[model samples]
Target: MAESFLFSIAESLIAKLASHAFQEASRLVGLYDNLRDLTKTLSLVKAVLLDAQQKQEHNHQLREWLTQLKTVFSDAEDLLDEFECQTLRKKVVKAHGSTKDKQDPGVLSIEDVGVCF
Candidate 1:
């Protein structure tokens, strides 16, 4: 039960982060880079779930491992949430026409932002 719950949370987080838009606009600002890295790490975590689930129940240490993983997962999710919030902040700033100049491609256009990605 613990193993399944952990992996499912991991899977959901991965899917959430993976679904973000990393197009040319976001690429210029570097959100794409961070997103890519996090996605890769999450993908690796997802890949290991099968093996982890199989072993977690049998090994006493696996419960501790799960605890550690849960901590990491929580941290990663928080980071992603911060990243997303930053992105939205930028979009909001840009959409409000605060400092959206052509020279500042760092701010993704409102059109570029689709579903917080």
Candidate 2:
């Protein structure tokens, strides 16, 4: 159960990392390098998770560690969600302009944000 959950989270994060909106957001936020590193790290984690899942059947410590890792993955997922939301909001504002032309300080106004990758 834990393995499947973790696998799903990793897959979701990887998909988000590859998304056009997220890629643009990362570039605007100057996280292109960080995003590349994260992609590599998550690939490693997914590889290790397969072995860990098999071994965890007899190792209580490994199970506990997986639980802790789940929390970390949850936090990472939330962070990616925030970036995706901010990027999408910026796109909407740029397409239609903000309501009443009131600028949102939180949403960045980026023109022609090219993806680093």
Candidate 3:
């Protein structure tokens, strides 16, 4: 049961990363180059998830390894979510600029409107 649960989570993470929104987010956040690497790593993790789960019940070492993998997967998911949030925050800030950024008498502050990344 535990193995299947983790397997499902890995599968869902892979599905989420494959979407257009995630691709766009990756591009926006400068992870475009690493996206393929991430996919490959996830594929490996997914491939091992079931096997580890099945063996864990009888093997102590495999069970410990799967626990570690679960932590890694959770952290990876959080990082991906952070990048996507940053992308969305950028879009929102660009779309609706601050009053100061939009106008300041006659001069627009380049610093205010500039995106660091």
TM-score versus the correct structure, for each prediction: 0.64, 0.80, 0.72
Each candidate: what lDDT?
0.70, 0.83, 0.74
lDDT of 2 by residue, 2-117 (tens): 98799889989998898887777779889899998999999899988888889998999999989998999999998788767666777877998865446476754443243311
Which model is ahead, 2 or 3, in terms of TM-score?
Answer: 2
Off by over 4 Å in 3: 28-30, 99-117
Off by over 4 Å in 1: 22-26, 31-34, 97-117
Cα-based RMSD of candidate 2: 7.5
Error of 2 at 21 (Å): 1.4
Candidate 3 matches the true fold with a TM-score of: 0.72
Candidate 1: residue 52 Cα off by (Å): 2.2
Error of 1 at 39 (Å): 2.3
- Model 1 deviation from the true structure expressed as Cα RMSD, one decimal place: 8.3
Candidate 1 Cα deviation (angstroms), residue 102 = 25
Candidate 1 lDDT (Cα, whole model)? 0.70
